[model samples]
Target chain A: MFNYIIVGSGFAGSVIAERIANVLNKKVLVIEKRSHIGGNCYDYRNKDGIIIHKYGPHLFHTNYKEVFDYLSNFTDWRIYYHKVLAFIDGKKVPIPFNFNSMDILFPEILSKKLQEKLLKKYPYGAKVPILKLKKENDKDLKFLADFVYEKIFKNYTIKQWGKRPEEIDSEVTARVPVCIGRDDRYFDDKYQALPEEGYTKIFERMLSHPNIKLMLNTDFKEIMKVDLKGKKIYFLGQEFKGKVIFTGMIDELFAYKFGMLPYRSLDLHLEVIEKEYFQEVAVVNYPNDYDFTRITEFKHIHPIKTNRTVILKEYPKDYDPERDIPYYPFFDKAAREVYAKYQELAERFDHLILVGRLAEYRYYDMDDVIKRSLEVFEERIR
Target chain B: MFNYIIVGSGFAGSVIAERIANVLNKKVLVIEKRSHIGGNCYDYRNKDGIIIHKYGPHLFHTNYKEVFDYLSNFTDWRIYYHKVLAFIDGKKVPIPFNFNSMDILFPEILSKKLQEKLLKKYPYGAKVPILKLKKENDKDLKFLADFVYEKIFKNYTIKQWGKRPEEIDSEVTARVPVCIGRDDRYFDDKYQALPEEGYTKIFERMLSHPNIKLMLNTDFKEIMKVDLKGKKIYFLGQEFKGKVIFTGMIDELFAYKFGMLPYRSLDLHLEVIEKEYFQEVAVVNYPNDYDFTRITEFKHIHPIKTNRTVILKEYPKDYDPERDIPYYPFFDKAAREVYAKYQELAERFDHLILVGRLAEYRYYDMDDVIKRSLEVFEERIR
Candidate 1:
């Protein structure tokens, strides 16, 4: 009898299995349907001899020190921080719209004056609103906002969000802040480094311990007939005997009796370029004129010594039932109401737990996931 | 001589100017380079008589009752929630991968086993690590993680991050969770809704105050020469008599003395389709198998009653100093170190204040920007 039968070898399942096995020295079995480990974060050199992430681009950024430190134990560190740029007005400016951008964007006199005005308005650590002109009755002020909207946010927001500016929340406009100074950093978190060797190394190290067992290219159904009794169940399969652990979605566990929830999926196209570098930055956003949101280059993320580079052109498409690796969990009210029904059904079970982004139906960063998993482990194991 | 000088007339600038002018009875002069208002969030009808966001799509969502109530003063609210879907493997799945996806994605026996295993493992609210199998020594458990990684993440990650999963961060893997159940909703927020009329209408009302003035096709540089002598200066020009407010880039403000900060850029290609609706969801993500990110359809975002629809194809590219808009700021350690120098230079000037995401060089959601702006407004006005 296994101490725990964990399902899905993704972040949630892998982390729990290792922790439980390491802490209690119990026997753990991890089941995966695909042909490899590391779940969605797995990476390897492709036929093009370029390092690639099978799932998608994964940049690590967290404000939590413990999460960073914990992951650091498994893999070496790389001092890489993600960068994003947008092609607009036929010019390249630092993303998040910064002060340095003005030099390249606006004429000398206009840029200078605009700088002075922003400085005075934002004295101290003040943040000015993008909707500053919204409540104005003055024709001039209103006109001014209209001008800025047309030049800066209007086109970009439309292409990105698929809605008009006024239709969006003022808060939405607020996300794109006007900068007073010249800082052009993509992220402002203290911890913006990358894994030195790679994420795969970390997974390899994390799963190298003795107490755990793994099955690749083997679905949970393969083990369904195995008798599971008297074991501290960590089942990540269809059936659980004792203390089964699930890291999948919460709604499907109950068989969607409350109706189907929504999710956003992704489709990617990749190519290998015969050059040392394809683009200077890691990712570039096309806000104004594109159906797609952005494109990514591998050299920026991997920094390999090979001359051949790989790039990914991403296109967003509707999620269909027949084909997709359901990625983003849709958490709208209707879906939530449906999910609530499933949650109620799940509550009926005494030995089952739902976890992770899919199970909880929340948008969580990497640190949050680890933090959440640790919290559960601390509570149950001790 | 100008009685009142307004900097940006977007939502923040326009709203504040309108409020101050109406409440304080002051004359305001608003200057704008672009021919329109609403800043980056502006919207209008195009040649097809279809309302569109000239810049990009925008969606409005907020939990703050005060914000909703405030915006409600302008236009009637549209009872619409944002929805997104992703097309993967020839199927359209709801975003935020849900339970119903299981039946569509996996074989019958495998799906059943996966559901049961996930439930058993996640019993009683226990959150497990998806990367747990990587830390296990058992060969079978390790294989499970590897399998899922290849099918779900390996190819996708390579396309998204431009790096192999091993080279990327495990935290990123943690960010993408698999759903055991199937349900599809785009966002998890309960307050997700859009304005019924559109963003332009709301802007018109927000900036209708009497004291505020309007100026279209007027750049900030043109107004710098018209100086204010005695009163407290809210300088929106290059040179100021009193206080100056800046909302541009910080590094360029002082010139690229510390060397140009790194940033990513993009290029976009847009097209108009005659169809009533292009896709089912608002946005779709392509993590693999594409050079571009995804395609966006305007009809889905706005849902206006029209026969013509617009769509855009997005492409991500490197930021050239001469081309593109700085949408995302790159936050590498090197960039921050350079920005630190600029920050110190900014501190020396007491008459200038830097504000917004541009000045701060941080990633903020729409609500956070509004909140930040409000905080700054409270500090300045009071």
Candidate 2:
């Protein structure tokens, strides 16, 4: 009865659902195992009337104007430039190891020398990843790179990925950069802001189209039977004539033909406190000292005026398929080889489409997820 | 028979018990209503092996060398200089409204002007209370004072004390100050550190004296009866021979004859996160925005190389006499008057000694509480 059946209601599926209903005038059914929409992006007003992200803090930021503009259609924006601090050597310094951070961490003479070297080497306001910076010929630059790598990146990488920085892909370390200038904002994006009325509200607006039928707390595996050889998808024992869009784990979709793909899951410790605020910044990274990765104070991101605030401490753990939801896909060489075989198998059915972070087996920011969903809709569904 | 009977086994009672047993060489019985001995200062390793304060984050910092030296006898120290950041207008600035904060908050011209004015007005490194700074005649200084009072002090006071700054005692406002210099450290105490193990460890060592008898999960009121007219105290309906030291709420002791004294209670939300760390600092203050006052990442205070971290969000609520433990006394005029009456009632018995924050109806930092207990032993019990 549906033109397209989408599994999962996160940014990937929801964005596709909205486009199918609105752009193509097609009936779309979105099946989500979670009780709420927005997948990991799910946020709700807690008992104390503070809007909190059930997972962790997700800041909406993008260099892509199309992605930003598309999302703007769903919700108004509250311009929030996110800033992060790393706790190093008993001091809270601006992260990305910017020039200001250089001044804070080192003595006056060393700081000035470092600042001069950094500005001369890198363009003003440019972000240089630690690994790239480490290759610099100068001793001071090498020392600065090593210092950041040890103090801010080394332990955090081990805790986050359960591997050393050198073991992981260079792309992973490249994501966290050391800035040359004094800009403290975490992301250097053209568009950076949170949804005016939380992320959930935006999802509500996007999925409000009459053609989009949403059934949450329903897993696709419960009803849909995939016949890869026959190239037929059956729902509730009947052959499903519509196109199938699977946004969940690719390994689970194929029943682990190439064995399970690895992922890093997170245990979020959330608390509602009595005070109006908690921390100064939206997020603070503890790379060298603690067991957890970071602490996020929700009020700092949302900027709601209330008597109480909400905070989440994020602990990274090895993803157990039995217990935890798949968060970050492990993109190691072994994970890639396993994913490649799954990708080849998924190609057997023309009607079956794989999209989003989980299906693609890649990490994505909010904007990239939206952009990916838009591409899937335009290329396959249309 | 015990030589001394101590009620409420927190810092006050524990310090006195240690002194009586170790210094005075006499048997001391300590009665605690809570199952733990540290009272509000209690901390323990949670299920995740992260040391968390059962009550809240209690950073030990004091200018009194004697207080530091005395506590050093019990536990080793991990020097932790406490730093706090105030979330104001989407930026995490150093608290105490220092020169660095001025630079971050205002424009370049305004920041320089304010910096010059602040240095000229107040001595370098001196913390000027907002009320005292507001007394400055210059417009720029007046604006700075008003700005800090409005941005940082006002809402936090209202949430903390349920009062406006002027409504509360000047002493309360005076406690939080604005520094003229760039020093971001919260306190300029002579000694600032956490117990190398944990606060609970220190309490364990302090109360380990052979002559000290600890009876946890037992309230003094349950076993002891005070006869003001007879000038006698009875334990389990029998006459008690030694001096009685009460550290509980003074109003509760007198059965609230002059009406109950006001106090604030905290609801702590604790979670074990997967990350190695959470916030950049041990504590972050949300002055303007949320209902909860602050979030504390415990590992930053007590650093141990582990894979996960623990954090606490503290919510402030009105003290429910039936449900909540009194954390902070509401030192308004009417509450002071009520406490004075309780003091008068207690003065009748020469053998009964009142000590600790609750008994005195005052807030004392950890070191001050220890100093007060030492003074009580030398001046009265000795």
Candidate 3:
């Protein structure tokens, strides 16, 4: 009865489902394992009117005006710039480490001298990568690069990745950099804001079209089957003619014909504190002191008047597919080869499409996932 | 030959002259006492290709889209957000004092507690004036207000105005505020940028029309005369029929008819340092230490590659009518009363219109002067 069968209700599956149903005026069914939509972006307001993300802190910021303009149709936006402070040497300094961090952490004379060298050597607002900065030949610059790596990036990388600083791949090592300017914002996107209503409300508006039907608490595997040999899809014991957009893990769709792709998960411990506020900012990273990577207080994100505040502590761990939610895909060379194999196998079935962080085995921010989904719809589905 | 006469080449006069010349296609003459145009906004490139402001730093930033749009016709804008730091307790902190300043100045525990109280009490990203904040009933918030006033505002006011902290009027005390959030930028305006070309270029473009005649090194009092009792104006032995837009000092134009209005002038000490750069940011306030109020490095504003840099130290002093150039009209109760008499006397002449900081006897920023000129053109000139 439906023209398209979406295997997940995340941004990847939902955006395409919405376009197909509204733009083409065709019937589409969305299947989901979770009771709600919005995938990792899902957030709900508690009794105290504080919107809390069920998974973790998800901030929406993008430089693409098209993406922002497209999303503006569904929800009103509130100006929000995310700020993070990393606990280093008994003081909390803004990260990705910048000149302000240099001032708070170093001695007055040394800090001023270091700043002079940096401004002279680099552009005023350039973000110098830790790995690239480490390659600098200048004595003071080299010292600064090393000082940043050892004091700030080293311990954080170990806790988040479960590997020594040197063991991490060079490509992954350059992700965090030292900002030359004093902008303390975590992300320097041109457009930064949160949905005025919440992310869940945006999903509700996108899927409210008459041609769209949703199935909660129902996994696609329960009613849909992929015949690997024949390269065909079957739905409810009948040969399904509709295209199947798979957003779940690519390896699982073929029933682990080759092997499982590696992933990292998190243990989110949420607590209710009997105080007006838990911290100054929304998130604070304990790089050197704790097992948990960071603590996020929801009151800062969605301001409220209640005295009781909620804070979440995140503990990174190896992904256990049987229990934990897969948050990030492992990006080492070996994992890429395994993911390429699954991608090749899925291409053989013309009706099967792979998208999202899980299906593509790539890490995507909220705006990145939406941008990819919009592009895929034009290139493949349309 | 001129249908309108403008007394100064500042924003207030130039904007009016440009409008009358281009929009109305009428002849207008601009009489500037200074040798060059652009008055206080004039800047020139030194031998090292550094664009140095002759008077002081003049940054353009405005929230009114119309004002930005109007100025966009003359020159391209370079995104420039002014960042300032004040030396307090041997550490440089951002001011208008913010949460970042609080973190660096106070003990960590005290800073954290003060931040919590501030966040709970005030809206994020608010510029709460020192006078208003000092009236807070909450104990922690009250302590924070008093602490900020003593550390950042008190001595700076004394240095700039040459008055004890208690002697300064309440109206002037509220100008600087404690920002609730950590935006280190001196301004939080929606549009903040500098002209890619020097500000003098803007004035050159403004008065470039053939109908706009510029009279350099000529005081308006030389060719123009105002009869206060008769309410008549004569230009060069002829009865001038058109409106005379006066941007010079109101007291000087009327020859201090009632009494001399007080003004404060600056002794700018421009030094060319051998060093590549002077300080981190463009401007740094020496609140407690230096004889001068602040030091401004020109290279920081207009970035260029040169070993030698230019810095200006401003020493505030009482205005001398015979030898000194008036920069600011002293705003006190007695000064305001005397200024009002001149204003009332100016209103008696139908063809005489007064505008700008000097004529209005008020402190007007660059944007404010432009905005006022546009309004006056619509209301009085156009």
Candidate 4:
């Protein structure tokens, strides 16, 4: 009998399963609906020996030392900063809209003026969100904010979320910021790198414990039943007393008791080009011109010895449960209210815990998800 | 008595000393003429609580995995890519002159034409030397090469080496390459970073072995003698049979017997400015503007919470044995001939081994020096 049942085999589920089996020395079963583990972070080698991310580019960056150290045990790292550029005014400029980007986009006089002002207002390395910049009363700052918004943020946000910048959560917009200095990296986290062997290896190593059993291509509904009225759960048609770590969609877990949550999906179009390189960096955003938000070249992230290069163009669209995969869980007021009811219902269960992006309906980064999982393991599971 | 006597506690000497003590379990004496260790790579926190590299900015970057793994024992590393920009034509552009620099310097149409020409000729990310680029038969490429050479390379080369590009060895000018891509890092080595604490700490930890003794403020000339005719080395006025790892200036060790191996020195002028940041990057080359070759802000390398910033301006000059530190050893045919003579003289001794930038008269990076030292230990000392 398993001491714990973890639904979903992403960082959240895999981490907890690994911890439960290794740290507690207890039997744990991990159920993954996907054919393989690593969930959305899965990457595999192509015919040309290029490691391509199946979903989109997942850059691992964080300021959390504990998170970095914890992940280090499973895999070695390749020092990669995850550079990104946004095509603006018929030229590609570094995104997160830095001083370098400003120099490329604006004239010398205006670039210098804007840079000086930004430095004066914020610290050298301060990352100012566009929304924060929009609140600026200063005329030049307002102009600068408007320029960045129109050139680099608006159309992309509209395409990705199917909503204006103001309609979506501010947290989502804050992901891409205006760096006061010239650092062109996507994130200025203290620890920024990629797993030497694609992220799947980290998952494989993490779940390699003798006490952990993985059920791939298996849905939780196949062997598990939750009796909400009786406040009891049954596993394999028997009464189960062990904890249930649910990392799947909260709405679907309770069979949409309240309502369905909203999410943004992506149509990932991949192309293998017969060239040395398609672009200078790993990712490039087309804010205004293209229907797709961004294009990612895998070779830039995982440098391989091949003349052929593979590129992924992401077309963000409204997610349908019947058709597409939920990539981003952006919340509205109604969705938040519904989530609150789900949380209240989840608390009613004695041994059930809700976690991960889908469960919480939060836009958590890779490190944030791991951090939460670690916290849950320490506070509840341990 | 120590089994090995090493002069200069830099990466070259310290690495060998540590290996001898730990790997071979042999007693090693490391003598550094300076009051401190780490040679030119020494760094410490100043009054403002900012780590400052005493001689100059020494950013450690290498493609050698073995060298990186070897050094990992002594210290952890922070992710740092040394970004250098040159002030050209009233604007700061990324150095090693790339597509980005070309865009900044040339008009839009000209920049496009030049970039297309470069791409057609070279693969993406290929680093081309200015000399090679200058010999281009293509009219557009030649024009572009001429412009880059005149604007960026020529003046900096003249200031740093005190010789025209045509006059100096082609090897010296090849160090600063023209990257075809938009990577703004001064060096694009696979591993680029700085020690987490400081370089001095690494040196301290490296020499912490009980078998390794460090002698500071002690010149080997004060106690050690080399008998050319006798082919003997003596330490503390006693005939010593231990291996002597000499990493000091080659000509000085032999009392300028082959005249003097030419070197370039720097006049480092440090200033503490009452501002948050003095520049956008850690280092900025002022090729055509000021007398000083470059300015480096220490805060960028080691970010700290101080309103006042510290910067170092380096003024290049001819090396004087009486004064100034020998920073760069750029050799002419005569200097190379002189170095060959010194190398032959040092090779005559039974146990004397010369390694490092100064001793070998080679422009070795930090990793190269460590690698050579490790090689020397394996081949000779071990």
Worst 10 residues of 2 chain A by lDDT: A43-52
Query: What does the lDDT come to for candidate 4?
Result: 0.86
Model 1 chain A lowest lDDT segment of ten: A227-236
DockQ of 3: 0.00
Tens-place lDDT digits, model 2, residues B56-168: 98889998899999999988888889988888999888887799999999999999998888778668888888888888899998999899999999988888877777898
- Tens-digit lDDT string for candidate 1 (A65-119): 8888878777767787677776767876766655566677778876677666566
Q: Write the per-residue lDDT of candidate 4 for residues A107-188, one digit (tens) a residue.
A: 9998999999998999999999888898999898898889889888888889989898889776677776789998887877
Winner of 2 and 3 under lDDT: 3
Alpha carbon lDDT at A88, candidate 1:
62
lDDT of 3 by residue, B1-382 (tens): 5689899999999999999988899878777776467889999765455788999888888898888999999989889999999988999899999889989998999889988888887799888998888898878788888887887788888888888878777777877899998999998889999998779889978987767766554567766788877888987556788899999999998989988998888999999999999999999998878889899998889887667899999998889998788987788899889999999999988899999999998889888999999999999888
lDDT of 2 at A252: 94
| Residue-wise C-alpha lDDT for candidate 4, range B146-202, written one tens digit per residue | 877888889988888787878978777777678898988888789998888879888
Interface RMSD of 3: 35.1
After the best TM-score superposition of candidate 3, give how far the Cα of residue B236 lies from its true spot, in angstroms. 98
Score candidate 3 by lDDT.
Answer: 0.85
lDDT of 3 at B35: 49
Question: What is the alpha-carbon interface RMSD for each candidate?
Answer: 31.1, 26.3, 35.1, 27.7
